[model samples]
Target: MLDDITELNENTTFVEEAKTIDEEDLYPFPTSEDEPTTKRFLGMTPAQLFVISIEFFFMVLIFGVFFMIVTERMTIPF
Candidate 1:
């Protein structure tokens, strides 16, 4: 590690200026002013709808496994 650090120190292009984000940084999505924008449901955006769909999928998967265990495993005698 010490030899590696020494070799890295010999290189002059290691340092660089860090770029800072400002308020002017906007998302790359395009929105047109002339098009009528549909209102969000309960203030939920499309991204939130996608996330909710993923959550529901996982919930169904977990419950399916849980119900299968209750039905299949509980039938065994103690």
Candidate 2:
């Protein structure tokens, strides 16, 4: 019984340490120097805007398809 309790405590400690390491890796706190600077939309190049627009359109199309699927409005004909 004592061996079992010791094993359980060791397992718990290992799990807690692993969790802490994983959390640190997943979300290392950003430093102040890593912060983004404010930029105006007018500063964006035409190519950047075009890429953004395309991404937005693609996202909207994906959402539309998802909505249709979830609503059971999508159909297949054999």
Best by lDDT: 2
**Candidate 2 collision pairs:** none
Error of model 1, residue 17, in angstroms: 68
lDDT tens string, model 2, 4-27? 654565545755656656545776
For TM-score, the strongest prediction is 2
Off by over 4 Å in 1: 1-37, 73-78
> Lowest summed-lDDT stretch of 10 residues in model 2?
1-10
Alpha-carbon shift of residue 39 in model 1 (angstroms): 1.6
Can you tell me which runs of candidate 2 are displaced by over 4 Å?
1-40, 76-78
TM-scores of the candidates are 0.43, 0.43
